[model samples]
Target: MLTQTINPTYFIIDFDSTFTKVEGLDELASIALAGHPDRVRIVDQIRDLTEKGMNGEMSFAEGLRRRIELLSANRQHIDILVDFLRTKISDSFQRNKQFLTEYADQIYIISSGFREFIVPIVTEMGVREDHVYANEFLFDNEGTIVGIDEANVLSTDGGKIKLLRTLNLSGDVYVIGDGYTDYELRESGLANRFYAFTENVQRQRVVQVADHVAASLDEFLFHNKINRSQSYPKSRIKVLLLENVHPVAVQAFEEEGFKVEFVKGALDEDELCERIKDVSIIGIRSKTQITRRVLENANKLMAIGAFCIGTNQIDLEAATERGVAVFNAPYSNTRSVVELAIGEMIMLIRNIVPKSNQMHQGVWDKSANGSFEVRGKKLGMIGYGNIGTQLSIVAEALGMEVYFYDVVDKLAIGNARKVRTLEELLQISDVISMHVDGRKENANLIGKREFDMMKDGVIFMNLARGHVVDIKALVEAVKSGKVAGAGVDVFPKEPKTNDEEFVSELRGLDNVILSPHIGGSTEEAQVNIGHFVPSKLLEYMNNGSTYASVNFPEVQLPKLGNSHRLLHIHANVPGVLAKLNSIFANNNINITGQYLKTNESIGYVIVDIAKNYSEEFIKELKEIDGTIRFRMLY
Candidate 1:
């Protein structure tokens, strides 16, 4: 959508630390020699040798010999290691399980790691046997001793190219992963693009050589700028851009290697509900509403982006209750908001709005009494979240006394007060600022009653929620001089999208600062917002992290215990969870660590098992009375 360029492409990803969380060979070292302190030194050496081999600092044969001598590893370690690698699939890779199955022909595994461990891991990633190419290990009759097959090309120079020749792959080859071996796939001209996928960990050497360095998988899809590969129709993921997104935001997804379809015009709730049929990722700005119907009809919908601040437009409770994670920009526009608040305070206190209005009307209304300096003023803050808290420091540095009121206890960053109630702060402050955010209960936090409680000649400013202050009541207060001046930045009837017509009721008012919701609209803010929000979303997509997420459980998905598993995303209604347990019970599936995480609309339940189960039945369980999306990835 950002660039009118689309192409067909195929990706050959690497294993080890790339597809899985840990390096396969290193994992083999750990599980095999758990209590042996001596092997730890060997692991460090093997790691260094492997790095050298990839970087061409040492020959592949030389590196392998050094590593083999260091470990003296046996067949027993590999047996345990195979079980460990089975559980380390990356989030971005795991989410694209359908793609792996569908694009089996185009997807290949090219790694310096052993085929013994890598093959089994990729199989769990939905990759078949014939598609995987790696080094092989030789086990003796006793099965305690081991040796690697020197016959394989991976044991020597230009090894990956030889393996590729055997496959005879067609289409633009994209090599994505970390490590020097992965980089060599490009250096030898075996791949068209060497994408340095640093989503997990970054390497300077890999980054320096990569045609492109993707911080996340979504970024990889966007930069590649390819939508669908003709080679893989059934498997090609169709990304739908619902509502309009920033040109840069669209580019970010395209580079990550997906085919994106963006519809620019605004749509009603019913229209959006109808449009999400085939979209894998539906990206929208603040306008498009992602309702329950839209979610239910989004048969292919994977993720949703609010694309702007405050996800009030979408039903978040419904989203969380339905097992959907909604992403938004939290601190992307922090500085812009603080500056706007300071400017509004100055404008309201100095009577700039009235002066400007009179000048525009061609009248010389240069009255001096109303206009005053903002030097010695007491500015009371209503909330102390990011924006409010930032404004506090800015206000205090400008010789203004700042008093803050927050229901949830917030530590005052600068010298600000934790007032017991709104009344206590209102009685003393000269300029009362309303910086409270959007919570359901804050519909009319500031009204005639609260305004009447303020100092008789105090000015007021609201740079936060539109509905926080009753606009009509404030307008009446300003008109009657009950409040000396008012600066209103937002309104309850604001436009949903950039294409809509915005109308305000407080038009043509004197001594009242009216900003068209420009509290967070600086170029710096916009640019940072464009990059930061998508980055965090991609981080969550690649790793199951919820750092800046507005709606969803915020916790790190720690290492998985010894087990194959079931991951279910379902609607958070009654009996659905019980039904899932009943199905497991009927199947006699022993469960471990069944983590249940929810926001408001959806529930994400991760199930681990000690035994193997048929994954094909997962599709059937999806139809289970109230089942949403049941995924059994082992």
Candidate 2:
């Protein structure tokens, strides 16, 4: 491990929007001026002033003076503000309390905000009284009105820099805050570097000039080589599962000592975005959409588990770019879907759907005219993947000749013939079934031209993606008797929830079987997916194994033996590996084992070293030029 010659002596932090999620004065105005005549006008003015001061458009002293004048608050309101700020602490900062307490002497809170609210909150973090450099308010005899202490150095525009300069700190100084005043500390050369803190608010002006940008306090601690395990335990990690992801998933996560919050149904974009802010992992079924906007707001999310076959509901590209791995149950539900396809094929070939519908309508025409046996009928399969290959073996056992067609060159199962073209399969087979993915190219894959190629008494079924088949074309083919019977488990336009009404073109057609997308909704499949996906998610989070990730570079690592593992994700570039090795060598740390994997966009490296490495080694590894994210797994 490596050691640093000069550790930071002072950690000057900002108070208002840096430590808390909301501006203290703005919140105070809302509470204090609740029933005032012009409460809206005053609250707007206070927010505008806060923005002006934080963006460097106006002096901080002027902004504070204007905000306090408009607040019209009393000493009683200060108590309310303190209690509110107590709840508004940054999530990541609160999670790393031990780090703050361990470095309390080196950390300093210098802000233009009043001491009334700052003291109670900072003290909870184990910060000493002398370490808090803030302005104090003067209260009257009745505790009804307050005035600021003009003599305090923090009341000025560039007060942070001026106060830090007077302290004459011995070692390197690092400034972490959200506003212009915090940036001034590094601009004036009093601090070594300025980190633009954006866990609560992100000011473009400050971020543009910052030497580094940190999303949360965890980012700062990780970069500084501070072990977060000292503060936040793995048990505190939060996992959210929506769309009724099976209870097995909740059990798996809870068994591993994680806090799991299970929601019964899907959430809209706005609701999901708000709920996902502090969640570390999310489990979703087909109904829940993990869009790009959701991924952008989920700063704390480390991984996602798609508890079904397809990951089309999630933005895998965006998740990978943000260092969030995406895992799916690609093989877990294969058996259920194959069984459903086989059952539907038998029902369609025997004309059971029309006969069932006729019986319900009180028609007694039970003559076996169109109904046929499945003894020697030819069956056609498309997309010979997991479900297709498995279905081939079962169809052959049912005394059906299987003819398969796939874009890829797949090996044929027993007695199953591979056709040269989809048209060739359509010409000879008596029944056709589709099982394709959700790729854009698969939309309308079976259209009018291909439907015209089928025989007059052929049966058709689609249990795959809804958009893969042309519903209008299928309707016309059924009406014209070109296709004798059809069974469809999926539709292009489906109701969002089970309570909603379902509308389809083939609703009242005889000999047509329409199901509500139950191909993979069996109890056995859901339970298997629940167990399978959560295990992959936990494996990636705890061991840094991306073996089944749909988006990230794939790497399966063994558990470190009495060693510490460092996971480094970086842009794919030259010399990054050499730079990482050099950092370890310079610190005299011996590497036990290392694994590296890369794609066109990113490079993932897992380094295992003896347990005696110094914190300086972590700091040096983070300093590498191309580092995107770094985590220590012990």
Candidate 3:
């Protein structure tokens, strides 16, 4: 933390779109016009008016009058709107409620919105009701909102400026809002600074003229050295996404206020080591290898997101040892991989590849000598995981008999039957596809011996890991006519990038399909993996929720409430939890909620406690024995 330097005597904050996440009158219109046929259009019109007033596109008083006339709201609607607005507080302000309580006297709720809705929300945040300043609403005998009180200066243009001048606040007053009028206070030299608050919304015209742009209240507080809920601002967390991960992942990271550095291609080990030193979170697909050396250099790495299904390119043991949580889209791309297998099966059985090639060479070979239909054929699946099960259903839909064999017993899907052994499936299968993972023992799982076990002219496909299949043995099988046609998506020594050349012995084989490891490269699959993997990484980073983490103890978490949350990752050994509990007891720390989960090698603990602690307490926790990584979030 930096030393306190920039201090202001007063903080003037806006109500709608700054303190809260939505415009006040627009929400009122939405509630008042519920079930009305014109609700959407009227609500949208109110929102447009709100935008116009904020941007100075129209007179503030005119916009306010038009919006109030459009809303047929009463006191009952206002009560419901207040309740909804309480839950719709901007995330940054909600997290920094402690700061608001501590400095309530210095903070003023200044806005062009009404005091009726603003007072209830700001008072709950510990702001004094007398300190709140805004426009007043007039209600008739029936408790229906008629219009704003015209006697108030806030009901006219230049309202915020006029209100600030009449109050004549002393010392340096800072303004924080999302509207052009908020900038007018600083422009008129009545305030020290104006921050275009954009946690809820960003008006570019206002942002362009402001002294600074604050993405969140935490950012503004951090820069000014005000005591905030979080020890470090989320803006400081740097995320490095490599290997052209989908843009959806980038958008997710940016939305969390984390600094994102995107690399279109994979980096080598040396390059990655240099770049990983300051990266808090890293995302990658295959091709980028995360070795032990790289993890050692990743001093600040909290989590790793594998945007693909397999994590073979990452060093899971090294990551676990360093207390780095690793996550992957385990089942997000399952459908895409299964669809590719089905497509390849049809193409291979129908001899589509050789026929296409022959046509491209200006030779018309229309004879159906070796072609066969996939219907009524036996389809064998080597693994019974997510991809295998989905493939079984699709293959059965094509009138094919489905057979599968896995080391772990799995329930059959649809008409698929589980064979006793790999040899049994291979002997009985007319078309075989591999879907196993990339475990060490699964290397060369299919070689000469396995190929010899299959019946003559068997159709083979391997969309699994490259090392699982012996390419040389597969080539010999194809040459000797033992295998009719084959589809190989992965290769043992594939090129690192699309620009690099792909060298394979199976390239020129007749009726063979050799793809560049694209079994799950469909657009739909990438988009799904893109959303799934980053969500896991962000959840782990934000709330200590390690659900579905590939290498860490799984502990799903709820949203953090009024207390502080502490996350501790340590070696899974005896006495660690006791030591943690003892430290908490000795330091007089009150634990509100506690959770602990452990794998064979690592233990994860989440504790929500009273938000009072000294630096010495933090130091003690960090120095605890077997502790790997520790973080505090609010």
lDDT of 3 at 399: 96
Q: Write the per-residue lDDT of candidate 1 for residues 397-425, one digit (tens) a residue.
A: 98888888889998888687678888998
* Span of 10 residues, lowest total lDDT, candidate 3: 1-10
Decide which is better by TM-score, 2 or 3.
3
Query: lDDT tens string, model 3, 449-563?
Result: 9999998999999999999999999999999999999999998887867888999899899989998888889899999998999899989888899999989989989999988
Which is the better candidate, 2 or 3, if ranked by lDDT?
3
Q: Which pairs clash (backbone N, Cα, C closer than 3 Å) in model 3?
A: none
Candidate 1 error regions (>4 Å): 1-244, 263-266, 285-287, 359-367, 497-500, 558-566, 570-603, 607-613, 616-627, 632-634
Give residue 562's lDDT in candidate 1 (0 to 100): 55
Number of colliding residue pairs in each model: 28, 1, 0
TM-score of 1: 0.58
Compute the lDDT for candidate 1.
0.72
Q: Which residue pairs clash within candidate 2?
A: 1-589
Encode model 2's per-residue lDDT on 239-301: one tens digit a residue.
999888888899898756576899887788899999999899999877778999999899889
Per-residue lDDT value at 267 in model 3: 89
Between candidates 1 and 3, the one scoring higher on lDDT is: 3
